[model samples]
Target: PTLRTSLPSSSPSLSPTSIPSSSPIYISRSNPTIRKPTLAPVQILYDVTSPKDDIKIYFGKDDNDGREGPPKPHEVATNVLDNSGKKYLNYNDLGSGFTVEVLDKCVIKGARFYPANDREGRDPSSYKIEGGRRRKNGRWRWSTIKSGTIRLPAARIKVTEPKLDPRFPHAEILFENQREFQMYRVTFPTLKDSDSEHSMQIAEVELLGYFTGGGVSLEGVRTTPISSSSLIAESSNPVSQKKRFKSTGTDRAENLQHSFEEKGPNYLLDLTTQYDMVGILKMNGVFKPDHPRYKKLTDKTGAGFISRVKNDALVIKPAIGKTVIRGARFYTSDSEEKYDPSSFVIDGGVEEANGEITWRRIRAGVLNMPSARVDRKTQNIDPELHPHDGVWFNNDEVYDMYRMTFPETKDNSVNYEMRISEIELVGYRSTRKLEESNFNIYDLITTIYFWRYEGSLTVPPCSENVQWRIFDRPIRISPRQQATLEWLIRAYRDPDTCQRATVGRPRRDGTGNVDVVRPTQAIKYDHLQVHCTSANY
Candidate 1:
């Protein structure tokens, strides 16, 4: 039953432009100045044709306990018709064909194997093998998968258009919050492609915050459970993991909270990056004690992050602000009758869904999409009701959102903890298809959770540490940008600063109008970056 796709009405809007109070103000509604992003002294990426086909090895589920045995002798094995489907297995299977889609929960998403048919790319001396048994065709060939490499270490940043004091709101500080402030760390110039100077192994580091406006270079790639109202966070250097303890107390303590029904197979963000909103900047990220829960943080309150409260009063609730919930809806609130923990209200309306996302296109030769003309009565709605379309931001659109105003410094003294304005990027990609149609024939083909991390902000108490950058080519957006990202994630989930404005029914309102709430920031994590280094629970 995995077949869903219902939203594509048309979306993409930002056009507002208004800074002229004689311009040059920098970013100060009162003490505003942060735009520092120049750090890349850490890196890792591998595609040596197949490193256990890129780590995430699977097969035999119910979440596995089959006890990890078969599958890798080079892990190119396959078998069609599994997952309650039917049957097919050619050498247990290993590449050439397979594809099926449906996740954001409609479930079903497979792609077993795909990478063998001599698409032509071999010559390590033709594998050096040729002197077989009975002749050269009797049996015993060897050499199907063996080429592992993913070294990383990098740093190259260049930004110079500032000599400010038009009031002073200039920025560039990536994770340096007074261990004696440390003169602002910005050293990076090491990766000629790195063969191994340890190849820059800092795994999941953090600290990135920024702001630079207009002329349209607003590059952004953030959204996937990384928030402090979506900007300014630092700290990515600390983890011990107890030592890889495999205990598993129920889906790894429920996959360590952040499940809005599977948002990005583990952090991803890619806001069509070309670079924009230039104002505040800072960055730093790494997490490798040997990851999996490496620097762990069951979130025992370091103020670093992960808060949603109200399950019988853990209190703190006012969710929704991953860019107004990704649709860039218009959410405005810093004060309006109620909902105000301290700022957020950009209301521009969004929440359109008919969903569909499944990939393996590498240049679109086939991953499939076609079908969707929708209207099976539009899938008939009420699957617990989502219904969103809201646009309410008038006052000339909240004065056109203070006319994009984000640069203002001078005695207004901007130090929201030292200046971290924005940066967030979370990503994932894993899909396989060895061969089959209509559904069924080898499984685990869709681990394609999308998110393109790193947007910069780390420096200044390193607020929630977010200097995440993951890009080696991964982009796919239109369906009206996924129904304007389901109407900007339902207008950036405002839940009212924490009285309860998040969880289900477009935030419920049987006609009560008490929905849409967000505001509860304080999970700063000091220097954040510990990519699931452990999860035994």
Candidate 2:
């Protein structure tokens, strides 16, 4: 499942005067558009986790609630344990141990655990506590802060010291280093000794820390667990997989004000003026004479049909080590709509010191060309397409890229060719200028809303290093344009072997249609972030 964080539509925009001097700032205009919410401080046990599905987790602000059964609809557990004279949150069935994730980043100096019953109250003989933090690149890293065996009668246990008195009922474990982290996990020994059985019963757990931000909110967090068997079945036969379409709008769509920014300058719009078109591979034929697509043996072959557009690639060398490409804008051709690429892939790479280009995939998905909209008065109307408007991907992990092989076009049998009047690439700088031009990339762009996530390239050697941002809207094309696109030929197929053959004779048999689109790929993991923007209109 995708975790969606919707920015408030009516969120207060940060004025130029309100920005902090310490923050890294970028200048779009004298008064650039920027909006971000204020961060706050908070301390709370946001979530508790256990690998065992049967174990129940209870948490609340009040320590004495006596409700029973599983947690209420949205609340954690309700029951409390009264051991001796002290009270603690009731947690039983110690399959092993559990983890607790705090609301936000904080420095945890220590923790207090109140045991329930005397037998179960005895601290684990051997225990270890671990901490985890999320990196800027969207990966989690964990390390152990302290680990050791607990002895009886050691009440105040400092991680550095050997032992202390007044232990058992309540043990305060202090750490040496007060490093900041988002979550922590505590594990216990699995040995089924007399003391180890049902030893996980705890009355209350308290963490000591200086936290930042309102405790982690689980409001929009979604989780979908995929099994290995489902993956195997999808890989074995892709056609059997269900097709799904992504829906538009969030609950807060009406109140959110979005701001857009790229790490580097927008050099993609200047490609035609700054870079030279070094190559162009046309979709002509190149097959053998013996191929069945040919009418006669002498008229055997021509250049075989090229499946995808090879000439569409435009390489760039940015000065920065890492480039985050957010989204792209595609333009239609003047004469042929079939020449427009309905689906495409974007790749990013760094020219290594050894002169090898280590490529990383940025995005691979479908780009829908808008069709004519029907009107009540008129039979059909031209689509409201513009050069600045961006066509977005659904961001559906399962079907958006994986299940659908071709663009949602009128005819599936026609061969599609890669044609474009212009292609805009964002978030990079060009090495040198090839010629001079007055084209302004920003002029064509209107306000855009997008969803971003960390993903790998759709093609092979799929490295998990790319950051993807998909726009929320789509560009439009005319009905005639859609028809022309479906009529384009991808390749000439040999009727005999049903393989690609050169256009020997004008034989329609075994003719390949325009289908240069790659199917959507499945999202392996579920860490997705969405950044949305509304149009000025």
Whole-model lDDT per candidate: 0.19, 0.34
For 388-442, candidate 1 gives per-residue lDDT tens digits of 1111110111000111111221112333211111112112211122656677532
Q: 1-537 in candidate 2: lDDT tens per residue?
A: 101111112222221111121111121222333332222211221112222112234221221223323333422221111112232222332323445654334455555554443453434445566787778999767698776654333332222222211233465565544355657765544222424343233434444444322112112221111111111000111111111111234522211111011212322211111111122212231112222221110111111112243422433332122333333444343433444445554444444455333333334434544332212122111112222123221111110000001222223334544434334333222223366889987543333667778877654556778788876654333333443454434355678998875432333432223444235667666646657565432
- Provide the lDDT at 45 for model 2: 19
Superposed Cα RMSD, model 2: 28.2
Clashes of 2: 34
Model 1 deviation from native, Cα RMSD in Å: 28.6
Candidate 1 local distance difference test against the native: 0.19
For each candidate in turn, the TM-score is 0.16, 0.23
Identify the leading candidate in terms of lDDT: 2
Tally clashes: model 1.
150
User: Candidate 2 at 454: error in angstroms?
Assistant: 74
